[model samples]
Target: MPKTGVLIETENGGVKAINYGLLTAAMGNKENEVIAFITQNDAAEAKDDLAAYGVSKVVQLKVGSGDINSSPDLCARALAAAVEEFELDHIAGLATAPGRDIFGRLGAILDVPLVSDIQSIDYGAETAVKSHFSGKTMATVKLEGSPVVFTVRPNAVDPVENPVDAETAEFNADVADGPKVTVKEVKASQQDKMELTEAPVIITGGRPIGAPDNYKMLDECAEVLGAAVGASRASVDAGFAPHSMQVGQTGKTVSPNLYIACGVSGAVQHFAGMKTSKVIVAINNDKDAPIFEKCDYGIIGDMFEVVPVLTEVLKASEEK
Candidate 1:
């Protein structure tokens, strides 16, 4: 088995590590060691969870005043240094946008093949199944050399609370002498409601919901279920929902415990954000919708009608 060094990308969503399924997956793998390199920005709040996930050592580096996500070179350099110092055999991270950025730079700097966006990672003598090529094909990879970098898909693996004795090591990491990009302004996305990624329960609306006003029922369902409302890219692009509510690669990655889909068609782009949910329930008009395949349970009917019924039943269940 290989020793795994996991980097926790920080600042915006310290919640990212808790949401991604790999934290549990890594801890469950007996032979793989989990290490976290946290940016100074999130060093305090995010450290405990990393430790709980079996992070052998947590390294902290001050990122100055720049955005960790935008500093691809600096991010990669820090992680690469840790890998070299620890002689780590494998490195893994979330497949989020910032993760992708750092993965490219780290792969280039480490001069190793990056097996990213994996659905499952099993360490044998030296082999694993990584679902890429639109999740249609699996690549059986053998990490021929040391420091194999992997970016795993969020929600693909289940995050388990595996507590371990953690050691926080404060280190002055090697940062890039010069930065390629400058962060002139950092504007956090503004929303009155909860962040979709942070929500424990999510109710996502898809294209067939008709219009934005129709969200009343979806909202009602979410309210009854005590969930945050979300939307598909198709619905967001249609102006039915705000971009913050979008669930996909181009949007926020969500790993809610319970995810309910209404009127969604189940596009791969949509499922990529929510497939890792603990329990998925899809309600669409068509039985053949792609979302049904990914759901643990599915309902075939119009969401407009189905959601209200569900809302009432859920509300009643809560009372009982």
Candidate 2:
């Protein structure tokens, strides 16, 4: 069995729910031995969650007496050392901002190829599938290396629970932290916006949303559904939403369980960003909108009228 190592990501001091999906991808055909690599987290607290997802081993990678949080390069080098020490056949992580940075540096340090933003993988064949040209094409890439690296798109694959008692161990990499860069202070986003890539449900507004304040309608609906709010590029361009809220080939990519596109015309550019959503619900006033052709469910109605009713219904359902 191939020994696969998964770089675990955590939020609020616990394993992020999205990491379980990467665990599923690393498992592939269920023959690979899954080993989880974690840093700055209590292994005992994380073991149960990782074990539920079939992780056989939990290796806590630490650098020195002080925390390695300020040094990303040092962290990557440490992870590379762990990969070699464990003799892992393959390694995978979520393609989040931090993961991308660390995995890219780790690949460079290891002098190996790093495949990123992959939708699916077949470790048996050493191939992974990635969407190209704004999701218009699917590309299968073959990786060639002793221990290949892969960064899976968040929420791209569903998590499966296999339940194993994962053993824990600690590794202290004896590598020096070069003074090249020291993270002075880490400031998180002040806004409470849910991460677009990891949100289970997203409610998006399009150009017809009229103005920025109009997003309040969607916000109300999203609050009821526990969803993040997104916007098409057109809405961003028109100043109806900020660029951070934009979703398109030029913006953020999302793979939520449910994507609700309100007043979105569904141009290919916008569709490319959210095509992987498990279920898409499009609401547009124009019956001939192209989104109708691609969405799993389509409603032809004015968003102004439909959204309030929907929010009320959801609120009523919650109350009941």
Candidate 3:
């Protein structure tokens, strides 16, 4: 059996929810031995959670030279050392900003090809499926080298529980810091909202939202659903929402399980970003809006009127 190493991402000292799905993908019909690798959090605390998704061994990687947190090169070098130390056949991680940075550097360090933001993988075949041409096509790519490296889109795979007893180990890598770049400081997001790409559910507003303060409506509904709030490119361009919250071809690509679009006109650019959502619900006053044709469910009404009722209904259901 091939040994697959999954780079586990953590938040607040716990494994991120999306890592479980990556673990599921690494499992691959129970034919591959899944090893969980973590850098930021305590391996012992994450072992049980990782093992619930069939990870048998959890490795905590530490660098003996410089701070891996401050240097992406150092982090990649340390991970490369671990890949060699463990003889990992494949290395996988989430395709977040940090993941992309480290994996890009790691690919250069290892002189190997890196495929990123893939929707699915066949570990046994060393192949992955990823979107191309602005989400219009999907290509199955075959990796042709030792220790294939790839990053999967968050929430692309459904997590399945396959419990196992896990053991933890520590790997201390002695890697020299590169002189290229060192991060000075990192700023956390001011809003304590779920990350747009990692969120399982997202509620988005469009140009018709009118004002920035009006986003409170979406925020309230998002809070009730435990979802992230997003804005269409039109809303962002109109100054009703920030660019960071924008979801479209020029913005963040999301693959949420449930995507709620309010007052969005279903432009191709916006559709390209969220086309992978499992279920899409659209609310608009125009019954013949293009969104109605693309959405799984359609509500023909003004978002101002439909959203409050939806929020109240969700609240009442939660109360029960």
Q: Name every residue pair that clashes in candidate 3.
A: none
| Candidates sorted on TM-score, descending | 3, 2, 1
Q: Which candidate do you rate higher for TM-score, 1 or 3? A: 3
CA error at residue 85 for candidate 3, angstroms:
0.4
* lDDT, candidate 3, 18-130, per-residue tens: 99889988888988899888888999999999999999999998889666677777778888999999999988888998898989988888888999899998866778899
lDDT (C-alpha) at residue 89 in model 2: 90
Q: Candidate 1, after superposition: displacement of residue 9 in Å?
A: 4.4
Q: Which stretches of candidate 2 lie over 4 Å from their true place?
A: none
Q: List TM-scores for all candidates, in order.
A: 0.78, 0.96, 0.97
Residues forming the 10-long window of minimal summed lDDT in candidate 1: 11-20
Residue 147, candidate 3: C-alpha displacement in angstroms = 0.9
Clashes of 3: 0
Global lDDT of model 3: 0.91
